[model samples]
Target: MAAENARQVEARVPPQDTEAEEAVLGAMLINPNAIPVVTDVLSRDDFWRESHAIVFDAVRGLYADNNEVDVVTVSAELERQGKLERVGGRDFVHALAEAVPAATAAGHYAEIVREHSALRALIQVGNEIAEMGYKRPDDVAQLLDRAEQRLFAVAQQRRVSDFLPIRQIVHESFDRIQSSQEGKAHEGVQTGFKDIDDLILGLFPSNLIVLAARPSMGKTSLALNIAHNVGVDQKVPTAIFSLEMSGLELGDRFLSGAARVSTHKFRNPRLLRQDEMDKLVRASAQLTEAPIFVDDSAGLTMFELRSKARRLHDKHGLGLLIIDYLQLMVGDTRAENRQQEVAGISRSLKQLARELKVPVLAVSQLNRGPEKQTGGGPRKPQLSDLRECLAGDTLVTVSSTGERVPIRDLAGETDIPVWTLHPDLRIGSRLMTNVWRTGTRPVMRLRLASGRTITATANHPFLTVAGWARVEALRERDHIAVARRTPSPAEPLDFADDEVVLPARVAEKVPDERFRHLAESDVLWDRIVAIEHAGETDVYDARVPGTHSFLADDVVSHNSGAIEQDADLVLFIHRDPTDETKKGVVDIVVAKHRNGPVGTRPLAFVEEYTQFRTMARSDDREPF
Candidate 1:
């Protein structure tokens, strides 16, 4: 009885279709064309027999290299890979070919093999889950999560997508393009910015768009704006995962933007005027009806995010997903370092986007590259500045004029001229510097109302009255580049001066040229010559004529505002010197559209509210 029981246990096997696997392999060995039909549908792991797996892997290798997949070539490949003997040599390869009735049923045979493979995988996953449960892990929740992830992995493996011919793909693509061109279909969600829409053609499904900027550069504001546009305006279901900000905070921001009420008024409802209160009530009603959902759970891991996202997608049919910022996401503990962890997170986010078939807008914080620069320029964000969030070989495709081109090439093709003021001029206790410093040659152009134009080199001191006279228009231009004073190598060091010593390192202190100049001149005490507090402005007698004065009105006094008067439209960037809570500006830049001519679109920025809005025509104009 014991021997019979053992034999019965040995005979019982996991699910598999040996005949299907043999037929599929035989078809591939007989006809090379049949390989493409099932290559995507099946893999070596799908074969239950080890020898069959080896034979299939050899055929796959040959097919991948564009080599013939006949019995002879497959046999040669298996021998080259030292797997011929393991797979019963050339006789087995020949036997596989002889087993196939016809290569026409290769796809059907491949499907049967895949079905059986999935069953085997399911059994394996169940056994693993049973083993894990038997151990009774301390963290039941974590164990359950692992079990679900394993099950999900098996389910994903079972999903087989067929390859379409180029003609079919092209026809579908043409239809989509035609619909978009005719304004009958929207290919992706609109960003609410017409200029940006023209440049990018809106955000497409399954795209992982990384929107990065320094803190307080309107990244959140822009993202919120887009979400509101899609959810409220277009009636699309949008989900936001705000790891840093609370759901209430996001709701308040949405109310502030939609109602045109200042964020300050939202926080302090008692201060809201009657008109603002009415607007707030209406905005709240509208938002309550919008298909926007917010999840403000803090410290969400990638797995948690995916699970929640999947639920939201299944229930609400999510059309768009937004991550408030990527850095705050909890990474895998097993990762070697932060970079590897972030890379893994980013890959998962991209996968989520594809699986859900929706655009994922991931907000990212730029590094302190701008502040660490020794050159006289404002630091602009670059792809490399993404901080190891993406792989080096990752390629981004942009579709324009019916042709898909690399994003790098598109940037080069759409290069625009940028200008900046002389950096030596002090602005808000710091030198005004160029943001875009590379390949920039200063060319001064002046157009008078009389249709006459004047051109000159920008070598003249831009801060001087003479330089101002040459510039008739300063529109769409912000920032200035100050020439750094080069230290003379021949100058002897003054060791006698107590303040003048060898370069010393200081903790948490950044070196600045303005401070160095003040130190050398023995005028460090004169730095605070003017103090402009809220509702009061005081100036000391020793205040410099053209230097920026300290202002406590949540504003920075800069020369760019004065320069705007001469131009038709000037780009203005404002930073709050006193408001450390936000640590950045609301409307950091207002310049020309990427694909359009130079112009300025006024956006109202309430420093106290930390919100941005389209300026009303009736609203009083303020200096930058």
Candidate 2:
């Protein structure tokens, strides 16, 4: 008995040693979840999974034909394109797999990876099922056979007394809190004209949320609005982590957006009146007094957020955590790959949300995938724009583009707000509907304007649908990314997929400042070659576009909008300078127009223009 016990004990790991303890604690400092990944990757068997093969394939597809695999660089590469899915998307590939092939080890390594991965996942599941408490498979197997014989059909088979127990826990939670009718009489909380889903999904103590978006749209604006509503309006203890911007910077943007002042103009303190200053002072004072906290670490780590968040809640009884964006977070593993690093960060955030029982709002970035879709038509954003994340209990994709037709002789063009993301203009982090529609319905007509005006009579005359939906969206965003796939696959693996090779000069250009800052002639000329070389996309002409003032090194493929002075520079977009030889396309001319602070000329593009700038690089590896 002693010998057997000694052998068994020796097989297992001893208690955490001093060195191991330091490493584990350090790794989890940013995100507690990094512990699992660090521990799991200790063995090849744990690192390799059948599910990972598909991730590798998607990763390989990102590079060009002239490129060779650099084992040290692939993970960071995928993270930039937002190509790595958070859940089972591209992020998953970077997460579980670390096998790097030698330059001489030939064939489609991606395909080989996928095949092996599928097999591994199957085996892994089987192993788990086999380990479950069997209490003798003979008795259970005989019992199952007898039940099948008596029931005799798949349609009518299930265990009895499923819900008979565990009824007590439900009633216990339900026992607390006031009833709806009684609760309504007390002054707090308003339904944004929409009937409350009313399952009572409150922000319990210590919850985190991920709220994501593209650029210049309104992520912080929306976040602050919620903080105001919760901390000041509802008296909930809330905290916000602003990684890229400072607390002061956040305060300025919030005031400018909320008060309808131009962000640039508001900086000049001399321009304010006594009353105006009072309003600003009052808003700031009210916010400071509220139980709202802010963390503005420019290079924030997941460990810092968790540590700060935990301390804030524990000490102050914090209720909610708001991360401005997920990418800004650094996790424990200094994984060689950025995409994998982000996956570790994301995994930590989800766990934090669950563990704390409070909703977390993490803002995310949309990939440039929509701009890649083809044809000379406006690209509507789908949930596909959100990188790393797929679908959650709630999801919201907000895309808005408006047009003005010169108000035909000075009525100053009706700047009709049109959400181009969807014809319906609302694809949600779904709560209880297949589609979230705007426009006209007898029951609901969504009319959100430039100044945050949602045209629905709130059950409480206070908030708008825009305000209401913002909260709803955060509450429903999935803790994990969702990938859209059906049983019948559309993209069959072509044994003859294109062999990608990157240009020797080009791959080196990624980290080169000189290559990025090339003179106009050289930059423009090289870009033309890359555009022509780029595999065909549906959105734009393959020919290179002429140079522009902003981000000249980077490719400019998005639908540009410039109305009067909205752009001080004229972008003479040219297609096929060699083939068509046209001097200019439609003269992307900018004139003057104003809609409050955003008053500038409108130059909305009918189609997006793709650029390959030598200057810009993905924020994966540092410039060597």
Candidate 3:
């Protein structure tokens, strides 16, 4: 009876399987092949006993170092780590090896150990949750969020996604293709924009779509429009978690979009006329009947958002989830820095999308680096500009010339202006070409055959009288000379005949007029020449007077004003250089669409309202 009572007491303890842990360790020590099998399922923390955890860690160290694993090796490693005595010496290690019958069942033994570890984790999580509930936090929502997150962590610990056979994958792919062919291809929710839909083929389930832009670039408006289209127009359930904006503000924007009433009118209803008031009322009525839900919770954590999203999805069958800007969402509390926090948040959002089998549209902020542009029209956002986000190989467009190029080629070349293209276009058209000089300075001093040195600039000459004289000398190619600028204005610049000028006979051999003129004039020209000599040609070659002569075509063009030959997207925004008007007008550019042809679809943006719409033909007259 006493022994039976003792058994009941022992059963009340937390879940653990010491024998299974020992068996796994024993298999790993005996058979080298068994290490991988057990490692796949178990981590060091999976061992119930502290000594076993230490021994397993030692074994792992040996395996990682590509060393043999045996009783002697594990003991030596533990000793190196100063943990041999802490793990009950070499006798305990030998005992563990004796516990396993063979290494072939290591996988089975690992499974048992993992099962017990998961159960213990679940019990710990349950206790913590219960304690939190009893404590009664001020924000009941936050409490629930923490509890659900802890439970999810427990679930994830036991979840193992193993490799599947190609046959199974092939069958699934065939079914998907068959469905697409049968006109059931719209498996993902549409964003209601025809051009965007054609490019992305709609937002697929378990996908995380990040829409990033600079401040006042209309990313929030675009996100709202998509959510409205899916929830109100298509009647699909949608949820928007706005950390930056309030529910009332979001509702006001929605009413303006649906009713075609200006946001100013919605915000200041007292200023609205009778006709506008009627439109507002009707729009509000329609919106009230829609299945779209909004949560304007401030400083919301990822855990809280995920819990709320799951609840909404389970209860009302959510079709789309939108987060109003990713940066504002609170990250892991234990994260060491902002970057780490952001990475954790991003991974969590992706996992949530997969878990719920729904598309997550996350709004993100672009870095200020793109916004600091002084020359280009209005700076366009790129995938690289995403705050703390890493995007693999992206297709970018040159904003100046609307040329498409890959992002990989642009690395370490940030000062070179580039924009991201919409992923819907295949071919791009050539626009107006602009000449860009690629040297230390725009203007260079040169000496003419008359022994007269003057400063000359590329393209249009400098307006200074002396500069014009040099320009004339360059055009006339008379008494050509080249010189380096002097540090002191009072000192005369030194001219080097051989260093700067080529022989007239050699210069005359070139077909390019600009090159011929430059060479004849003895101007050290080592930059791309874009001019109309016989016809327009992008001259990438330049002759180095002192160096061995080769075909000029060998030199690549690095012109800032001209577009890259391999540009993928053209990101354009309308902002007057004078800054007279508000800046927000943007076009979604798809220079190399993965699914369709390259095209630019204009969207009307009102800076005051922070709203975007399909640009009307009448509005096309406005500068962009």
lDDT score, candidate 3: 0.59
Q: Candidate 1 regions off by >4 Å?
A: 1-164, 371-377, 387-624
Best by lDDT: 3
Residue-wise lDDT of candidate 1 within 41-64, one digit each (tens)? 987778899998888877877776
lDDT of 3 by residue, 1-624 (tens): 999985885578788988888889999989989997888788877888999888987887678667999999999889898999998888988998889977899999999998899998887777788778888777776677667766765665734345655655887789888998998847679877665666666777887776656676677788898888788878899999998999998988887777667787655668888887787788788789889999999999987788888778767988999988777988744443343355567777877887777888777665453544546554544332331110112233444544444433444343333321111111111221322222221233333332433222232121111121112223443332222221222122353544324434455686776455444331232211221122111112111111111110111111121111112222322233345453444567543332335555666566554556555535431111
RMSD of each: 17.6, 28.2, 18.8
Question: Can you write out model 2's per-residue Cα lDDT over 454-566, one digit (the tens) per residue?
Answer: 11111101111121111112221111101111111122112111221112244355665443332211111111111011232111001111110111001111111111111
Whole-model Cα lDDT of every candidate shown, in order: 0.55, 0.35, 0.59
Q: What's the CA error at residue 95 for candidate 3, in Å?
A: 44
Model 1 weakest 10-residue run by lDDT = 535-544
Whole-model alpha-carbon lDDT for candidate 1: 0.55
TM-score of each: 0.47, 0.36, 0.47
User: Which candidate, 1 or 2, would have the higher TM-score against the true structure?
Assistant: 1
How are the candidates ranked when ordered by lDDT, highest leading?
3, 1, 2
Superposition TM-score, candidate 1 onto the true structure:
0.47
- Clash count for each candidate, listed in order shown: 13, 64, 21
- In candidate 1 the C-alpha lDDT for residue 116 amounts to 85
